[model samples]
Target: MTILVTGATGTVGRHVVRHLLDHGRRVRALTRHPARAALPAGVEVAEGDLTSAAGLEAAFDGVTAAHLITFGGDYRPLDNGPRIVELAERAGVRRVTVLGGWREGTLEPALRASRLEWTFLQPVQFMANALTDWAGPLRATGRVREPYGDRKSPPIDEHDIGAVAATVLTRDGHAGRSYHLTGPEVLTARAMVAILAEATGRDLRFDELTPDQVRREWVAEGRRPDLSLFRAFSEVDGAGQADLVEMLLRLYGTPNELATTVTGDVERVTGRPPRTFAQWAADHAHHFQP
Candidate 1:
């Protein structure tokens, strides 16, 4: 079966493509820059924009299932989501796996309304997001500073997210399911800083800052960002950040205060255990240090 994968170059999507290729499935990867796509041999690369369905016809042709990332481009899911689903349905695509973020958005609801077999993969926060956590400051000054040094989350590995997506895309029984993919541990920012310090053998400090301070730093980085998303970090409503620690602990299989879950779910699906945070840090330590 030919599977169409959008966001084929993204952190999670890239792993999906590689795993699909490894499984001997026909993959038609969708990207705006086909030439730049370093897809595996035998995978077909289709140049298209998810924002405009006009270029997607050839990509969806003869595809049986698909994987999609919500932020196609320009973040206009209202305009592009339904069209993409409509085209997939018309092309006789039976199953779709949507990789989603935690925030409320148009794409999630739209996919819920579609007639196709759809599975939503909602990861709390990516382990990769922690790149922003320590990479820059470590490079500049060997310090990772942010607010909520004690606030913990079940930050997942992107490859695990891809493994879940591949399972949903390639198999049955996953339709209408929304998997809250997360790491096997709830790690605080301070704890993570220590992990990095041990991994890199460098003295790393986790500096806590106020919400306003984070906003100012982010603004100074480049263009202005949506403050609500950043503010959501500090605004620990019961349903949001406050619940994250509990949710992650539940997903990761940790109890008490220190025992972390080390499940084989990733290996079960993709023939590998999910990479640990320390392993991730070690591999990416250069990115964190310099």
Candidate 2:
């Protein structure tokens, strides 16, 4: 069966494509720029935009299953959900997996009302955020300055997210389920820093930042350079960098059950335990080197 993967070049989408290829399935990757996608050989790269369903006919053609992202470019939730669902239904697609955002988007409602088999992959914070948030500082000074040093969460590896998505899309009995995916263990920012330090053999320190200090630093920097997921906060109209910074600080500083809870959904779906933060750090240690 040919499965179409949207966001085929994204962090998790690339993994999905890889796992699907490993399973020896026909994969069609949909992207706005196929030339820049750089997907693996033997996969069809189709140029299409999820925001505008008018051009997705060829991408969905003959596809039996598909993966989707709730957000479009700049992490803004896609508003043309009904149209995309209509196109998918018309194309004879049978299954779908959505990598959801922090909040529900237009796509969920449309999918819920459709006849297609659907599963939601609600993953916690991605462990890859450390590369964007801490790697630069560690490379320069061996220090990770951030707020909420004690806030805990089981950040899942992006690879597991991809694996779970691939399994759900290819298998049956996953329809109408929403899996809250997470890593195998819970850890705080400081603990994660220590793990990275061990992986890189460096004395990395976690310097906790106060809310006001984080604001000042963010203002000075003029952008939220820490995590790509924070870009989702900019989806609001007229929301500036300062607004995004505040939203991120609130999210990281505050305690939330869903953010901190560890779940076995990844292992349950993929038949293997989710990778730990230390494992992730070890694998990507070279990126943290000076």
Candidate 3:
């Protein structure tokens, strides 16, 4: 079976491609830039944009199952969901797995209204956020500054997210289901930093900032927020920087059941326990190295 993977070069999408290859399935990767995608050999790389499905006919042709992402460029939610779903239906694709974020996009509704079998993979947070948000601070100053140091959540590894997606796409009984994926254990920002310190052998410190302090820091950084807040507010129009920062602070500071919930769905689907933060940190320690 040839499986088409959109967002093929993204954090979770890359892992989906690799695990699908490991499953001995023929993989077709969709990317806006095939040259830059650099996916594994033997996989068909198709160049197309998810935002505009005008020229995507060839990409969807002859694909049995596919993986999709809700957001397009700059982390914005895709507004052209109906057209994409129509294209998939026309191509006779049977199954679809969508890697979605906190908020549902236009694609979810379109997928629900379609005849295709669909599953949603909702991860609470990604462990890679350490690399995205804290790596520079850890490398430069040996300190990671953020709010809600004690707010706990079980962040999933992107690799596991990919594995689950592949399993759902390739296997049956996952249709019309949504899985909340997470790591094996709960951890706070400070706890994650401690694990990173042990893994990278660096003198790392987690500095807890007040809500106002966090807002000021984001504004001082020219309001280019990190992945955590950026993805949350990507769909909000004309939202001021302070509004974005406050919303993030509220999200992190509050007690969220979804964020703190750990599920066995990863092991249930992949037949293996999810990787721990320490394991993830150890595997990616070089990214934290000076």
Candidate 4:
């Protein structure tokens, strides 16, 4: 079966394409720049952008199943989400897997309203955040300073997220299911930092900051950021300084309340237990070192 993959170069999409190719599935990758898509040798790379509805016709052609994303260019929601699904429906695409972030967009509703088989993959947190939020700081100063160091979440591995998507895309019995994927256990930022210390053999530590301190730092770092407060920061972009600080306030703003819970979805879908945070740190320990 020919599977059309959008966001083929993204964190999860890269793993999805790799898993699909390893399984011998024919892949048609859609990216704005096919010349730089840099997919596997056997994969078919085509120039297509999902941000606009104009050039997706050839991407969906002759594809039985497909993978899609909720947003378009930036972190904003897709304006052409409905049109993309409509085109996929007309192209005889039977099954589809949608990779979504914290919030739902027009795409989910459009897919639900359609007759095609659809499954939504929602991952709470990515273990890769250590690299973005802490890795640089750790490498630079061996220190991680932030608010809400006690915030707890079950961060899933990007590979596991992709594997779950691969399972639902290539197999049956998962349609109409909204899976909340996470790692094997929940961990607080403090615990995660301790694990990093062990994995990297460094004297890394977490320093708790107040909300005011974090907000000031975020503003000072950026030229002019539109800072908004929320009960919870749910977007998956941990690198976003504004969102990170706000999320920290919401997380540490309260006491002993987990923003995300643990789930067995990964094991249920892939028949393997999700990887642990320590494993993630160990796997990426080389990156932590100078």
Candidate 3 regions with alpha-carbon error over 4 angstroms: 220-227
C-alpha lDDT values of all predictions:
0.71, 0.90, 0.89, 0.81
Residue lDDT tens for model 2, 1-290: 99999999998999999999988999999999877889999999998888887669888999999999998877888998988999999999999999998678799999999999999999988998888778898999999877889989899999999999999998899999999999999999899999999999989999998988878878776645666656667777898778778887888878898788998899889999988898899999999999
Give the 10-residue window scoring lowest on summed lDDT in candidate 3: 223-232
Which has the greatest lDDT? 2
The better candidate by TM-score, 1 or 4, is 4
Off by over 4 Å in 2: 220-224
* Cα misplacement distance, residue 34 of candidate 4 (Å): 2.2
Residue-wise C-alpha lDDT for candidate 3, range 1-290, written one tens digit per residue: 89999999988899999999999999999998887878898999998989998667899999989999999876778889999999999999999999996567799999999999999999988998888888887888888778889999999999999999999998999999999999999998899999999999988999988877776778766645355666668568887777777777788888988779999999999999999999999999998888
* Candidate 2 minimal-lDDT segment of 10 residues: 221-230
For residue 206, what is the lDDT in candidate 3?
95
Point out where model 1 deviates above 4 Å.
74-78, 102-104, 211-273
| lDDT by residue for model 1 (1-290), tens | 99999999877889899878877899999999988988778888999987777778888999999998776444333346777878888899999988774344566677788889998876666777667545766877887655567766666788788877887788777788766666777777688888989888888888876655644554444423332234333323444433433343343333333223334445554555566677777877777766
Clashes of each: 2, 0, 0, 0
**TM-score list, all predictions:** 0.79, 0.96, 0.96, 0.89
